[model samples]
Target: MMPETFLSWWQFNNARGKQPDMSNKCPPVLHVPAAGEQAQRLAALSQTFISAFTQQPQFFTRAPGRVNLIGEHVDYCGYAVFPMAVEQDILVAVAINTSGRLNICNVDANFPPYSCDINNYEINKERPVWHNYILSGVRGIQDEGGMQQPFIGINMAVTGNVPPSSGLSSSSALVCASALGMAHSHGLSLSQETLAEICARCERHVGTQGGGMDQAIAFLATKDTAKLIEFNPLQATSVTLPPGATFVVANCLAPMNKAANSYFNCRVMECRLATQVMAKKAGLPWRTFQKLGDLQRALDKTLLQMITLVEDSFEVRPYSKRQVCELLNTTPDELNQVSLSENTRHIQEFKLHDRALHVFSEAHRVWEFKKVCVEGGAYALHTLGRLMQESHKSTQLLYECSHPKLDTLVELSKGLALGARLTGAGWGGCMVALVEEDKVEQYKEHLWKSYYSKEAAAEGRPRNTLLFSSPPGPGACVFVK
Candidate 1:
């Protein structure tokens, strides 16, 4: 079914004028060609599955990667995020197997085939090999179904073009796709929201300690409309883009895998520590607060007031671990148990002021961006653009996640794009720019010549996929042939 079908189904099942209710339902089943542009790709993947397993696939699952339009790093803070699903996604073809072994292969030859007993497999956090993402999903479903329950084995062939480690949620997409396949193969019926939440928790098995933005957008996004995804009961509301405004994603050609290092989690811990300190200051149970959003709510303060509180509370200097322990009135061991992840326990210092500043401010920008979209006018594009630029500045300066290449891309877009910001978990990945529809081609041309054309990484890379305009695409779904 097309996205119109999703909308129509929503209309059919509910009273008029209410928002589309997509909860408590399985992903809509569609025919192969209903997948549109990727029909041929799905067909080829299905053929590969047949040859590998000697049986036709019972079904296929697709989960799209998302580009965060404005909100960044706030999802884990329990704030809302605005993101749209891209056409690029992870596609899995699955068939039941009788051998009681889970066989996994990739359409891309770089990944070697692997098999394991479905009931006995471990996700590797040490190396985070490509298949481990899929394994994260398998483990998620197995746990969800209860380990004591028997599960039939499955053969899965995977393929994706979301640019791994490019901050586009490719890893999360794989996890969602695998979990969806596993759930369906086992006669389990799960909603998109349930699967998304499960995949989000399970992905931590790979050691990223990420928030749920990636997985939530992957499952809940709708076609042609960006979604404002709120956590703690994950809900999605569609936001329409203003007319004549185009969003383009360009690769910085630098990739950072969140699981391969501690940079990502370090920021997560910084936010956590900031929240606890503030909670304690506010006379709330510090241990109960793990997110800045939750802390803000407990205080019943607006985002602006939270920003002010951060300024009043934390010194600008980086807080050494010892200093942090002293402020919290706890020993390093107790502090570690309360605030730090395993990967971040070794960290020496935390920039509580800057990280808190960024999260609170960026969380505010998400709402502003949505407001500009909701109240579209002659100045809506420019207003939204300005908010995006501000977001980039905070991410670069305060969060310290932006890479030199990403900064350079934003610098290059100063005039050509209305606004541009590093889109993903930033150490290196892609930057999203907002451009007038008429200026999009010129913007791409300028970026290619000034940026990609001069880099060795771009020497043989395809320009179309590397730099492209993206509208919101549909969420995860299953295809029945």
Candidate 2:
């Protein structure tokens, strides 16, 4: 019955031309391929699942990794982000088991198999366990009251192509796939928006203060189109790219795990503190404002106005803990208790000014980028490219998240690509570049000789693993036979 219902939903969605509403009753369907590359991939994955678990998979859930085209580090600021799903994604092949336990294995032997009772399990936060991501989704659904019926155990074989810790959103992809798998296994129905919100909140259990761009894109992205993902209401509007434009993603080969360290959370805390400080200076209830966008709304000011306020209210230098407490009119103890995150409470200084500056500037760039995309012309691509370049500069200088290797990549790509920038939380991840369609091969070859080839030769490593040319791909879906 569950398999038939899932297939019926998939057939219904496909019959409707692939555009579905966000109603609560209708479950989101996965891509059902008739005959093509996707069909081949699905067949191969199904075979692997059967070989590993010794049973045919009921259904497969897929969630794509994303690349931020223009908006960087602004999603949590309550600003719109420009991101599109990439070809790389996580695929989970699942079958129900009556054993009342989740038996999970990864196709890559590097990740060990994990097993536990489906209804009772804990996520290990201190260690970077691979299966903990799946557990996060399961726990998310359980907490969201999706387990009204008796818990159904599952056998899952997970596999993915998204590079880990390279800022292409591999972790979020896994979590989204797991959430979808759990929903299907239990015969649960969920809208894309509901699942996106749930997955975003539950991923916090992994200890990364993420802004929901990855999860949103994973759930909402459409084929060959970028999304203007706005927060507060959590809606996505499709933004078509310019004609004959190509985007290339190049990994700097440095992995920055947001959960393993406090850098990502530290930035989040700084932005939160900045908003509170600004609200206090304006004589509003500072504690009520957690995001920079909220403060802007409260003041009814434009992005430029908010930039001015940041310049006027905060100094360029780092603000000491004492200074922040004094500005907010609170004690250090009270500040730690109320304002700071668990990981950032021990830090003594904050870069409030720089963080605020970056948020406001980046938010403005996002709108400008959308405008150029909407009004496509001969120079539209160039204008968008220039905005991306400026965005990278702000992330590098003001936000201080860009790594030296990323900077080197951007600099080296200056002549080859129209514009290049770090696409994620920065600090050693992948950089996305806007290149013309004809120049894509040329750009890749140039990068190979200049960056990948030289680095591989010098370090005695492989060159092909570091770079990729990504086209926009579809969002989350279940693949059925």
Model number with the top TM-score: 1
Q: Each model's TM-score?
A: 0.94, 0.92
Where does candidate 1 have its weakest 10-residue lDDT segment?
A: 13-22
Local distance difference test scores for all models: 0.89, 0.86
Q: Which runs in model 1 stand beyond 4 Å of their true positions?
A: 1-24, 34-36, 145-148
The local distance difference test score of model 2 is: 0.86
Q: Model 2: what TM-score?
A: 0.92
Model 1, 1-481: lDDT tens per residue? 5534643453354334332233446677677775556887888898788878777777799999989999899999999999999989999998766677899988888888899998888777888799999989998998874435677678999989899888899999999999988876665667888888999999999998888999998988899999999988899999999999899999999989989999999999999999999888888888888999989888999999999999999999899999888877889999888889988899999999999999999999999999999999999999998999999999999999999999999999999899999998999999999999999999999999999989998998899768998889999988878
